[model samples]
Target chain A: MPYNVDAVFQIAGIGIIVAMIHTILKQMGKEDWAHWVTLIGFIIVLFMVAMLIRDLFQTIKNVFLFHS
Target chain B: MIQVVGLGVVATILILLVKEQKPMFAFLLATFVGIVIFLTVIGKITEILKVLAHLANQAKVNQFFLETILKIIGIAYIAEFGAQVTRDAGQGTIAAKIELAGKILIMVMAIPIIITIIETIINILP
Candidate 1:
């Protein structure tokens, strides 16, 4: 299977946008909102990684444990 | 391989750009790219192991021994990947603990082979 390079772009785009929002909010003097934005961005990226990890674990199980 | 390296380079650039303002996100980006790279190469790893197993079978090596060795290697790689990711997230203590667990698991898995070796040595002596 070919690697899905788009996923990397998608994640990086989210990170960049979130960072932008955070800086904008902080400049506007809303530090609390800036922090929340950063947290949300982190959680979104985390969810994506969590799914990838689940897939990795399943592959590992099939590869290492149940030798067909 | 080239594709994976390109992706990593792009991710690294992005992470560097984001690190100043959002260090947490930068760390997450690094971890995500690491896993993505691993996943992309996993198919190649499986293919290589299958070829190795076939060669071992042809050479009259014990299948069980080959399988155990492969499993131990898999555990080591997975555990190292996990620990490194944890360390990248700034949890050095937890990373060390993960390494300890992997070593313990490897020792447990190797016991049967160790016993076989010892038994063979005993049989050959005097």
Candidate 2:
């Protein structure tokens, strides 16, 4: 409905935290864990975006009368 | 209106902050903000279209033609939004392809309108 200002901050926070964890893990010689952390963080953000996109497309189809 | 501007500025600042550490997140944030802005404005767009449709009906315009035109407009808007987002991510080639696809689809939708106009013109000449 309204603009989601919180989502912007939430994503930024996740990115910062993920980057920090990744660097820390790499420094500790756990490259695999670092990659995993990045992957998981990306997937989380992707899920959030996927839901938003779905809503967007649905609204478009309804407004434009895309019966298909 | 102010809210949309505020959201854009805030998102831009946040994107910049995230870009230094994670460029991928920056791109996703850009896309997320874009979708949010579009979603927020869509309601207003629907209201405007409703008013236009009501006016068209009062004027006895063909409903099928109006529907086709609206579909064309929607396709253009979607294609432009998608291309701009893709370009924001530095994929100029993909953005161009998206635009091309949109143009073709719009032309396809406009074919019936074009045929109708041609038919009207031919009938008037007789």
Find the candidate with the highest TM-score and give its number.
2
DockQ of each: 0.57, 0.72
In candidate 1, stretches whose alpha carbon ends up further than 4 angstroms from where it belongs are none
lDDT of 2 by residue, B1-126 (tens): 988998899999988998998999999999999999998999999999999999999999999988998898889888998899889989999999999999999999999999999999999996
State the displacement of the C-alpha of residue B30, model 2, in Å, after optimal TM-score superposition.
Answer: 0.4
Cα lDDT tens digits, model 1, B100-126, are: 999999999899999999999999997
TM-score of chain A of 2: 0.89
Q: Report per-prediction Cα RMSD to one decimal.
A: 1.9, 1.2
Model 1 Cα shift for residue B19 (angstroms): 0.9
Instruction: Tell how far residue B52 is off in model 2, in angstroms.
Output: 0.5
Q: Give the runs in model 2 whose Cα sits over 4 Å from its true position.
A: A66-68
Candidate 2 CAPRI level: medium
